[model samples]
Structures are given as C-alpha cells and as structure tokens.
Target chain A: MGKGHPTAARAFVDNRERAHWHDTALWFVREKRDRQAGSLPEWELLRETASSIKRHAQSQLADYLLQFEHEATANGAVVHWANTTSELNEIVTELLQSVDATDVVKSKSMLTEECHLNEHLAEEGIDVVDTDLGERIVQMRNERPSHIVLPAIHTKKEEVGELFHEQLGTEKGATDPQYLTEAARQHLREKFLNADAAITGVNFAIAETGGIVVCTNEGNADIGVSLPKMHIACMGLEKLIPKLSDLSVFTRLLARSATGQSITTYTSHFHKPRRGGELHIVILNNGRTELRAEPEIRDALHCIRCGACMNTCPVYRRSGGHSYNTTVPGPIGSVLNPSMDPKEHNSLPFACSLCGSCSDVCPVQIPLHHQLLTIRHSVKEAGGLAGSKRLSMRLASMVFKRPWLYKLTAGLGKCAVRLTPRFIKYSRLNVWGKGRELPPTPRGSFRKWYDKNGGSGGR
Target chain B: MTRMEVAVVGRTTSRDLILNKIRAVELPDVSHPLVDGVLTGAIEYADTVGTFVGSAESVGARVHFCDTDSVVDIWHDICEEFGSGKTANVGIRGLNDDDLTDDSPHSASELVVYGTSGILGVAENAAIWVSDRAINHRVSLCLTQHLVLQIDAKSIVNNMHDAYAKLQDVRDDYGVFISGPSKTADIEQSLVIGAHGARTLDIIVVEG
Candidate 1:
C-alpha cells in the first residue's frame, strides 16, 4: 500500500528551501493565469459556455463518439476504442507492431501516463521516447510525472544539468536551462528524424470536422508527427466536443488558464492521414463512463488537463504534486482518483484546504471543492476512512452532542493539553499533530471569557 | 429468449459495453451556445497589420512590415541573413517542389527556409495559418531551421474567433496555427525559445 498524502507531503516539505520555491513558482503561474483571465471581459461567460458545452457533450457522448468515428473513418483515418487502460495499451502495441516500429516518439500525454503505456510498450521491446522536455527528464529518472503539465516541476535545474551530463554529455555542472534545452532539442531532433512512429495526446477531438487538435508550446508534436510515417493519437473518451466551432472557446481558455499565454505555439489539427502516412486515434474509456454515472460529482469530467487547478491549489503548491500520488495530481485528481478506487485514495479528498481557488480558476467552471466534499462523504460511506480519522470524528461528535460532556471537556481539555508534555501531546496517535503544533491552548474557552466579562451566567 | 435472459447475456464487445454505459449516463441535456465572431473584450486594433507585427514580435518572431513591392527585397535580405541556402517555397515563385526532392519533409539541407508560405495572419495572437494543402511538406514549417511567412495585411484578423470564422471555408485535411517560434518553459519553469521546431520565425507582412 502507498503512503497517505500527509506522510508523503511531510517528506516533500522537509526540504524547506525547495518547498518554499515550489510554492513561489506555482503562485507565479497562478498570478499569470489571473492576468490572462482578467484580460477577457467575457471570461465568466466563456467559462459558463464551456461548462454548458461540456455538460451537453457528456449527455450525448455516445452519439458524438459515433459521429466522430464515422467522420474520422470517412477522412481516411482509423479509430480504435478501448474500455480499459490495458486494452488501450494493447491496441497501440498492435498498431506499432503492424508497422514493425522499433523506435517511437511521443509528446506529453496524461492518458498514456495513467495507463503506464511506455512501461507496457517497453515490455514489448518497443522503445518509446518522451519528447516533451519535462516529460523526458522524468522519463530519464524513471519516475512518474508529478504534475500533468509540468512533469519535471519538482526537479531542480542543477539536477537536470547533471542528468543531461550523464545522458547527453553536457558541461559537468552547467545549470542554465537555455543551454540544457538546446542539448535536448538537438538530441530529440535526431530521435524525431529516426523515429518510425509518433504518438500524441488529443487536446480536443472535433466531431464535425473529423479532426483532432494537439496543442503544444514547443511544437514537438507537430514535428514528430509530421516526420514519422505513422501517427497515433490517444485520448480519453471525454475529450470530444459537439462541433468544430466549439474549439475556439476551449482554445481561448486553455492556454490562458494553463501557462498564461494567449494561445499555444502550435494548435495543429489532424483531419486525415499525412499523404500516405497512417493516422490512428485510440479513444480510451478507462472508467470515464463510470465517472459519468456519478451524478453528484459529474462536473469533474469537464477538466481539460490545464493544470490551472494545481497551480492555484494551496495544498498542491506547498506539498507538491508527488504528495497526491496519482497520475494527474491536485484538485481534479483528488476527485477523479476516489471514483476509481475509494479505499486507495480516500485521504486525497481531505488533502485540500477547501480554499475554492481551483473552482475559481477552472475554465469550465467545475465546482471542485463541492465535488471534493461529496467524494469525502462517498469515501467514508464506502468504509474507506482511516481508523484514526474515524476515531477523532467520533470523539468530536460525542462531545458536541451532549451539553454536559461538551462543557466538561472544554474546561478540562485545555488544561490536559497545556499540562501534557510535548512528546505525549504530539504522539503518533495524534494524527492531527503530525506536521503541525496545536495552537497555544486558547487563553480560555470563549464561553468562560464571555461569562466573566458580562454574562447571564452571573445572574 | 426472455428480456431478462437477453440482458444477462448481453455483455459483448468492449465498444458496445462502453457506449451502453455512456448512453445510461443521466446528465442535464444542455445545448451548445451559438458563438459569433465578435466577442466581449476583443482587442480593437487601430491597425491590424501593426498589431500583428507587435504580437508576432512579442512572441519571439522577427517581423518586417513592407509593401508587396518591397517583399522581394525583404525576402532577399532575410534569406541572406538566414544561411542563404536551399529553401522550399510554398505559394511564391523561387524554389518549390520542382527544385527540391519531394521525398521526405526532413530535407538534407542544414538551412531550409520556407517562404511565401502562410495562408492568413491572426493579429490577436500572431498565429499564422498554414496547411498541408499549400505547404506540401508541413514538417518544414517546424523541422526547418527557419520559417519565413509572407501574409497579406488584409488577411489579418483581430482574434481567434475571427481567425476561425475566416477558416470556415478553408478547412484542409491538416492545418496548423503557428503562433510563434517553438518554445518551452518545462525545464524548471525557465522559458527557452527553441525546443524542437524552428529557432526563428520571420514574417513579412506585405501591406500597402
């Protein structure tokens, strides 16, 4: 079993310097998002319209998928469907094998990460190199990407330089990002030119135009897909939109909310195969339909994987994405992971401070905090709550239910806490006291202080 | 078979099961909103061409504002600075598919400059539209060392909404909106100008 969020976060925040900068860096991105979102006077309307569009799409998803498949097939492209992650992986492997592809290049794809596609492909003896710089760094280190958008957000530049020195043979201690990126560019360029196939993630799949849009800032997807003879695009089944014109709304909000840019560097649309090349899109369900059945939290499906929620999440910014221990970490992950496995990720919903910043910045206007709250109840009802948390809640309920018990404990609990030794008070049993010190016992209960000042109790 | 028996034995292909699950999902049936090209807070560009140049320059593209007559001179000067080597021209007359080997998008030349190549210019974001229909070799837009786009000033639109509106009739099998030269801030959030695509994007906005 994996450690809970608090335990992992303790290790993350242990390095005070890194934690501080991590917080500052994410906050900087959050501020940038604000500036971009603020630039649009119709931002709220856009969010509402996007939310409406997503809901409409969710309602008629099956029809849109059928429409998309029909149009795509007519456009001379092949469409594959997968009900599970393993099935998706097998389909991609078979496609690559059909072409006798030995070397493959892929751009940033959270779905592939969720399915561990690279690991699966590697077992098949097919080498798939991640082309995104951050993704490549984490790939080299044999680690899961902490954040969906910024895969190497947790790694320092010096560490990247060291990795490059060992792998690509750069200057021993050079820490400049510019110098390091240039090296990766030169290296990945060779990989792109030599790669037999290219795989990318679909940003938005238009049903009307039979096109799948792949947005990128580095232009990696375009170069790789264009150079290779075979291009396979993988996407979650929820990425479909009703019309081609619906793209403008998302494209407007996506880049602004993601990296504060007006738009990505490349928004390449693939409607058909390149000349004689093969275009195959693998649409993976992977429990998306199950997630859709959850009416209370169904709004969570509107996520475009922008990472804006992560950038604005106080807990995520401080504790880091690694603490979430999920493929797509932060607010959306907390809500989505519990739906997949309640027992494993029950602690995730409680990780948030309930600041509602995620909901505020969400381009699609998903009520994230509300969904997290609902998921928390669902987790407890599913018998996924930790015994320690259950015990604390039971004790609190016991005291609050009875006036005598509440008054008695209120008076004695402070003295007990004050008199107790630090070690005893902060024992392993006190899960609440793990990373934080209980605030100095409030001078006195507010009830007692109010009575002393001017109270009916005196009468 | 009875309905219950049929339902019990209905677990078939994954696609069927997946689509059935989606069909069972109960969500509020919302409608797609009608979108017009004119949107709120749309930037009013006093001069669309001038704004295009500024937006393009800000995003790391070298911009040249010239008339159709000066286009030749501008192309010549930029080409001289950008290696003065083999180039794959798309729409303009210089060197095209006839001159180069139409074999692969990855030309053997170290310096491949593509010119007279853009379909339109988007002023709001500086994204120029180009497609497989015109470019023939789409990879050269990114894989090449440099990209030189020659866009008519009248074709520049104010924002993405307008850009898409103009593209209603111009849909190709594969098209791209090249906003700027390749860039990435993925490595520790430090912005790098060139990643996998062209290092430089020079635009020749041919106006009156």
Candidate 2:
C-alpha cells in the first residue's frame, strides 16, 4: 500500500532492454553458483554445519564479543563499541583524526555505507577514496552500489568507459573492459600510496584467535591496509564466530556461493597491527541487538553477506537492486530493513513473490522467505496495511466464513466482472489488475458443476 | 557539542548497554558444529605437479617445473624475461639460498618480487600458502607488479581441508592463501587479470 517498492521497481523495469540484461546477468551468476555448489559432494553438509555454528554463536553472542574484545586488546589493537550508526561514524571520525589522516583509502565496506561514513567524513573535510574498482566507479559516478559483490553490475562498459575517461582521462570511447580497468588501476594507485588511513569490512571475526579475515578478489583490502599506517575495521556484531577453524566452513561457502569461485583470490588474515601502525576494530550494534531479541526471525542473523539470495531471487533479478533502497538488497534486505524500521520499510516484505529460491541457495540456510512471510504478518498486525486493503481483507474473511454467501457472491461477482467495462476493470482501484488481465468468467462455479455431476456430497 | 561532552559520549556506556541487551535475550542452547570428517576422501591428482601447473595456468599464472640443480637456470630465465630494464627484488627471508637478489634498493614499487614458498599448495584451487614469517615483508607480495613464488614440488596438497590442517599448526601474525594474480569481474562481469595487486604470478616448483 505504501507503493515505494512497486513504484521503484516499475521505473527499473520500464527500460525493457536494460531490465532483460539485468535479469540475464544475475541469473548467469546464479547458474554459476549452482555449478560451484554441485562440484562439492559435501555442500549440503557444509551448509548444515555453517548454520549450526551460527546458531551457537548467535546464542552466545555476548560472550563471544567479550572474548574478542579481550583478545583483540591483548594483541595491542584498540576496540570500540557503537550502539548506533551516528556513534559508529563519530568513532571512525575520531580515530581518523587521532592519526591526523586527511586522506583515507577504504575497501568495500557495507557497514560504512550503512553508517553513511563517507558523507560524514566529507562534512569534516577528510578525503575518503574508495579503492575497490566497482566501488570507485560508483563513487565517481555519485551512485550507490547496486549489488554487494559486483557493485557496478548495473553499469555497462560504455558507461564505465565514459566515467573513467572523464575522471581518469582515459582515451575517449574506449569501452574495452581491460582498458577501462587499467585506467582505474592507474588512477587508484596514487590514492592508495598516499592515503593516511585505510578502512575495511571484516568478513569473519575469529573469537578464539582475536583476529579478522578480509576476503577480496582484487586484493584491494590487503593493498589498502598494507600501505597505510593505520587500519580500521568496521563490522556488525553478528560477524563473530567461535574459532579460527570455523573459517574452513565459511571460506568454502562464501566465494562459491557469491561468484562461483572456489575462494577469493586473496583471503588475508589480519591478526595484529603492522609494526609502527595501529589496528582499530569497531563492533557496531545498530539494530542488531533488537533483531536478536525477535525469536522467530533471529535466524536471519546467520547470513554471511554472500549475495547468493539476490542472485537466485526472481523478483530481485527482475526488479534490480535499487528497488530495495537499502544498503543490502534482495530477500535478506526485505527482512532486515523492515525489522529495522517497519514504517518506512514495511513495503519491502511484499516485494517478493514467495518463490523460496533464496532459502534454497542460502549458504547458512537463513530461511529468508519464511522470515519475509513472518515480517508481513507483523507489519499487518501493527496496522501498517492501508485502510482500503484492511477493509477488503475483512470483507473477504466475512464472505469466506459462510459457504452459501461465498457461492452466491462468486456467481454474482462473475456476472459483475463480465458486465464491467474494460477501462473500469483496469482502473486505479484495481491494483492487482494494473499489469495483468482479468480471467473470463467460467460457465458456472465448480461446486455447481460437481453437484450436477453427482460428486460425493457436492450439494 | 563540546569536547568534554564528546569524550564522555565516546566512553564505555555504549558497550555496557549493548552487552546488557545481548545478555537479556533468551535463546535455545545450540551446540557448536561437528566439523570433523564433513568432507571425506579429498580429490587426489595422479600427477600432483602436472595438475598444479595446469590448474595454476588455468587461473592465469605461469608455472615452471625444475629440480634444485636447475634452480639457477630457471632464475636466469625469469630475469631474462624481465630483461635488463627491471631488476627483480628477491625477498631475503626465504630465497637467500637461491642467490637471486642483486643490489637493488628493495623499492616498494618494484616490478618483480621473488620469494620462496612457506607451506603446501592446494591442488584443487591452485592456492599457495604464505605467512608473514616466511616472507621478508608482507607488503611485497601485494605491492609488486609481478610475484614469483619458489615452491617445492612435493608440498602440493589435494584440497582445502588439508591446506587448513597444515596452516593451523603454524603460529604467525598473518597468512594468505593466494590462488592467482589479483583479478576482478566487477565491471559488467568482465574478467580483468590485474587490479590492485600483482599482475603476473609465476610459480616455479623445485624438486623437494
């Protein structure tokens, strides 16, 4: 009823050619994931184990966080806890200022995006350069990332060529991917060398070892942090697992599920700060604590941010990532966003077609579609449904309770629909019929036909 | 806000509040996952070195096989490939016996970085394990334009499970499992060989 998701999705699908390209592109990734998962005979067992580990970790999140903090501190790294996004941003800003860092280089971090850290840093006159090629492309173009793994999936090579030509002075109209990527390589090389600080998102924070693992294909995170004198890692509190051995389970599933790679090119373990440098880890609890309180939907926290759900989702593939209007998108985003703020994001849960592909591909088996269904029920119970929708539901429930009334209304409704004009049938009041046609009335109701055919107790 | 107010707001109250919230949540006790033997019968290669070379090459890395007696000739060939314009900077930690280092300044932006392998290589993903202690400088592996890793031919493992088992015994500050040269398909799903790290990865396997 809010119409936010549908309106945005309509805008995305209006460009039929681009919409088709987007759907095919994502489905291709999904197919690749299927192939990668099929290569491993223990893929299902791995998923079960990963899900069980996450369940254990989430149940004891407080203890794990405390242990991680203690070990991280003992390793001479600074640890900070932020309860809100603004607090997270302020903590990062203060850390950057403490190091007197005016130029900061960052790898792909969804946490920073959620905290709006770039905008916050810009207000304070600190320059932050996104070092990931996809992130940098979107940064230069002044756009949000459309996908988590492939941020620039929505932008074609021609668009990227133009953007780099304008920003990095590449040869005009050079739409070749290698050329565009090389040009960006040259451009980001300078930023990485001169950056005073580097920030990255933590993939998995090992509690037993008191370290973090940052995975990337381009090695941007490794290069970004290695060059700078200060490294700041920001992560949601849900990223913690119990031990270093747990990575064997997750590392196997992450890249295979995301991009169909056996593993990312570089899975660098950051255990300690480099000599003459500092490592600051910020653990953010922005809305995750509240999510943890909800028993029915708390399994959503097991997500490893693999983006497989988005790749496999039919609605997400067709609608595009921008339709969700959240930091993370697709089936996971629908459940997470509404839980964070139901009033604004209540429409997200209804965006799905309930196909259940998301749950099938989830590496940790998050039961994403089930969570979406639960969120919808909660939203409706909280009176988030529109007035007309609520009234219509009440009317349908009343008619459904009485068999005689239902049959009479069904017979009359068929006549009414047949008598109605085409324009009136497809009018604004009929939300479901906007992009669809109404079925022609049957000769009679099935009950009447069954009674005539002498079916058992049909009358 | 004043500086005092900012400092006070940044204190430990938020940590306490978050911990309190987490502690209050009542959840069913779930045991840790049993990870032993989930993956059994690792994939074995009849010819380990051949499979390693093929898999490495498939991932855009050049592979050379030689014995200890031919190590110098292989090093010379690597040098000749780079030509006289670029002198390779051999890391002092692992490649001291190879005699590949010249009087170069060990610049951070060196075109070629030669180092010896630290641990076993995984045949399944063609990934070689390197740790901080094994390499002279950790940044050299990432900053160099070309990375040359000298590995022993017999240390190749069958899969990742064996690779992790080997790594768990070593105590080091940092370690990485690099499968190939830095690559990205971020732009329109186009595979580009080099992005931020080494553009060329050459693995030379010497007889153990």
Candidate 3:
C-alpha cells in the first residue's frame, strides 16, 4: 500500500517557508474564531441547540423534506431530488439546457465541487464561470480548493498576481490584493451581466417556509441569482432544518466560526424565484443516506460546512488541505471520507493526532476525534493496512497481553536503545527519527521503581 | 431528442428513490432542544443608536444619523460625499419621499442605488434586514458601486434571536441581513473592501 497522508504531507512541507506560512495563517483564523466565540456568552448553549436541532431534523428528514418540497412547490419553485452525484449533475445540466443557457455563472458551492458539476457540464459544452474571487482564482489556475471557506489559502499573493496577469490580463507584478480584486471585479462583472443562468449552494434550507439561505462575504451568490432569469440551487439532504427560527441559531454561529465575523456581509434568503423567473432546487443524497445508517458516523451529518474544524486542525494546518486528497479535507473529512470508501481512503483516519481541537471548535459539537478513532478500528478490521504493519500491530498486542513478556521486552528495548549506534537508530527503518531524536532509556521499569519506593499500601 | 427532454424523463423516479431512502432510516426519534430560555439574556446597549453607529463603522460602513424629516438633506450630503453630479447614475426606490424620486431599478457598473430597509436591525452586529419589498430589484443592492440604505433607528433590536422573532412571520420572496459592504480576505488573508459587490455602503439612520 502507498504511504498516504505522511508521504503527501512531506511533499507539502518540503518548502519550509511556505509550510510555516500556511500553518501561521490558519492559526490566525483559528484565533479569530476563538475571539468571536468567546465574545458570545451563550456560545456553548448555541452549539448545544444547533446540534439538537440538526439531530431532530436528521431523524425526521423524510417528513421535513416532503414538507419542504410541498411548501417550495407552492411557492413556485421546482424541486428535484438526486440519489447520486452523477444524477445531480445530470439534473443541473438538464435545467441549464431547458433554459437554453450557454453561459452560466456559479457561486462557490462545495456541493458542486463534490459532484464535479463544472467538469460534467464542460463535457456537454456548457461554460460555468465561478464567481467567488477565491474560487475564480483557483478555477483559472486549474487547481482545487485547498481550504473550504478560504479556497485559495494554499496560493501566495505573488502566484495569484501571476495568474491574474496571465488570465485576466492585469498589470504584471501587481500583487496588491486590492488591485487584484478590482481586476476580478471588472472581469466577473461582465460575466454576471451576460450569464443566462446562476447556480448556488444552499447554506440552510428552511422547511417551514421552503426558503434556502445563501451566505457570502463577496455577495457573488446574490449577484449571480438576481441577474439571471433561472436560479438553480444544489444542496445535500442534510442542509434541511425544520423551521425558520432554527436559522437564527445557525446564522449566528456560522460566520463567527468560519471567519471570526459577527455576520457575513450578505445572508440572502431566497423563498422563491423572482417574479417571472425559474428556481430549481436540487437535493442530492450521494452516499449520505448510507452514512446516516451508520450510527457511529451519523453525527457528522450535522456539519454546516463552516470549516472551523479545518482551521483548528494542527495536522491540517501543517500538511495543507490538498494532502487529504478528498473533496472535503481536514479532521471532519478524515472521518467522513473513510466511511464512504474505507479501502480507498483508509489512511485518512490515520492523518489525525487525535488532539480533539476539531471537536471543540465544531459549531455542531460533532465528536470528530472519537469518530476518527472508530474509523481506525473499522479500517483495521477491513485489513486495509500493509502486511508488515498488521504483523507489527499483532506482535505488539501479544506482548501487551502477557505481563512477563512485556517486562522482558521492555528491559531488552532499553538495553538495545542504549547500545545501538546513531546510524542504526536514525536509519530508514525508523521513520520517527528522521526529524527527531530518541530519548535516553530509563534504567529500570516504573513497576520496579514503585516496588522499591513503597511496598503495596505502605505509602 | 434534445437534452432537456431526456432530463425531464427521470425526474419522478429519482424523487421516489431519494424519499424512499430517507423513509427507510429507522433511527430513534430525537427531540429538538428547548431554546426558549437560552437566548433570553443578551447584551443590551443603553444607547441603541450610538451602539449601532459604532458597530456599523467597525465593519467598514459609513453611518449617518439624521432626523426623520432631514433624510432628504442627508441624502444630498451623501451624494456630495460620493462625488455625484447632475448626470450621475443615482437610482432610488421604496423611499416614499418626493424629493428622492428616481424610479428605474437598472443596475449598472457604476450606479448608486438607494433604498429603505425592512423593519429590524441587530445592534450587536449592526445588521439591517432588507426584504424584496424594500427595493425594486435585489440585484441593485449588489451590482452597484455604492449602496445607500435608509433605516429607522427605532427598529433596532438587541441581538439575532430578537431580530428573528420580529421577522419570523413576514413572508417575502427574498430578504437579506446586510451587515456591511461586500468584502473578501481570500488573497493572502488581506481584507479587500469590495470583491464583486457594492464597494461602499452608506447607512442613513433616521432618528424617530
């Protein structure tokens, strides 16, 4: 088996400066989230309430979804459901074709990324321009988003400047963010005006009013949907909530957790299409239904995609998002991806240090670290590890079970470490010794020391 | 056969399959958490208008306070600040003032759109609620160079929970809680004022 995360992370960390920059940058966001969450006196209570609401919604998803469809259809929207990613892509392509749309502008939707909708549409000769500034940057450079909320976190300003200089024809060597943003604004402005259809991802879909909320700092979702005659919104089935009031709970926590902002600049709630316009809502259940059946991983469905877990993950911070090699990355992705395809993504669960920072920062209070631990057991049960590794684990477990054997091995290990030469200790067999040193071995076992200091209950 | 016709064929069957899968989920029922008392105590401002102005300014928005009757004069002042001449593309809607009567809602590249906000403003976040009825076109709020909103100072609330309570029943096709101008920190974590929306947002609070 290929070494998955460690090998990929080594590639990312090869450039020490860039790796350090990425770590510090994400830590800054994590700090900002801490400040925002700290400022709220009822932040913990809010998280509890949000988690409960999501649990209740998921348990009764069928009822809520049907109610939403009824209300939305009554509100003059056409709601479609897809059982797979290809089905969702086909639905979106059909919607665009029905409108005879050639040019489509899309806001940043991780659901679309998951479905690979842009590539699917491109095959049929449809041009979908991503409108979010960061998405647009990465789209032009032909790279996937490294960070979910901040799609281009892996990209440096000079690299962005070079990309814009080539794609948008801005002045060469113009690395100022304000200057680059203005060029994107001018270029995307034209695309927005002439686009025939707009596609967006739903942040929250309210069951009571049949409305979908799309939050953005750049207002790209609002601009794309408002200008076009047809608005197509795609959402995972988990985005549904029972009532409109639950939105207040999520809306308050989402932007604060994502970017340390009190609120996004625009939180647009689209109840229906504009007068004389078409609104198509596509709900996709690609492997999420099976995920909900797994009781151990069902809580992960509560994710609102705020991306706080990613920013707070130490391994993710150093390794970067691309190293996970999944549509969603970080601690949550590690758990969710393996559950979907264990053999293919078995190494993802091993990517964590089990620090539990992701669980603490999660807005919905998903026990992410515990979920990763569970997935690790499942991976082992499936025999996803290499033969040598499995044998090593079995030997270790055998030694751990027998006290005398363990004691003998521990004593021998101490002697072996003390007598080993530096070259042997730091050899290729010892992966941990590459950037670290072996600590000096203790002369005696802790049990022996405890016996000598005080017998049984003397202390 | 056209692509549209082919797509229309499988819509019903796909819907059935998805709903069936959802119905098959047999997990135990989970009750929604009781949030009745969780949001009761919020940070209150002694001076709501003052707090609103400070909060709005902190989020990169310019705030102006004027008496209800001086809204027109304040609009003129804002226009002057934005360097508006007689031939400027200033579009105003939903503000029932004869002096502020520009009716066309066409959003241009460099147009300035003026409108009134729906009831309710959160003091903690300086967010103003605007529904579809408050403006002719929602695109005008986003597709303009600058957005000038006229809000009533008396409608400010303490926090998001209270704001939701006030707007829970009103049914509009579209609405938004705009906190400030459009912004992005996507490039090297640098904050840029305008990414693809209104570059500047001017809030004219009308004192009751």
TM-score of the first chain alone, every candidate: 0.95, 0.94, 0.96
Chain B, candidate 3: TM-score: 0.81
Return the top candidate by TM-score.
Answer: 3
lDDT of 1 at A320: 93
Interface RMSD over true interface Cα atoms for each candidate: 2.0, 2.5, 1.8
Task: State each model's CA lDDT, in order.
Answer: 0.85, 0.84, 0.86
Q: What is the lDDT of residue A322 in candidate 2?
A: 87
DockQ-better candidate, 1 vs 3: 3
Q: Work out the TM-score per prediction.
A: 0.93, 0.92, 0.94
lDDT of each residue in B1-208, candidate 2, tens digit only: 9995776676589999999999998789998865552345445678877877877887788888777777757666776776664334453223353232332212455555454564778786788888766344567677777777777878898777767766765646778889889998888898999989988888878775
RMSD of 2: 3.2
- What is the per-residue lDDT of model 1 for residues A1-459, given as tens digits with 9 covering 90 to 100? 567888889888898899999999888888999998887777898888889889988888999999999999999899888888988888898889989999999999999999999999999999999999999999999998988888999999999999999999999999999999999999998999899999999999988777899999988999888887899999999899887777778888998999998889999999987766999998998888888988877888889999999999989998999898899899999999988877778889999989899999999999999999898888788877889888888999999999899999988999998899998999888877867888888877777777889767563
Query: Model 2 misses residue B176 by how many Å?
Result: 0.9
Lowest-lDDT window of 10 residues in candidate 1 chain B? B3-12
* Top-scoring candidate (DockQ): 3
Q: List the residue pairs that clash in candidate 2.
A: none
CAPRI-style quality class for the chain A–B interface of candidate 3: medium
Q: Which residues of candidate 1, in runs, are more than 4 Å off?
A: A401-408, A414-419, A441-459, B1-12, B35-47, B92-98
Model 2 residue B15 distance off true place after TM-score fit, in angstroms: 1.7
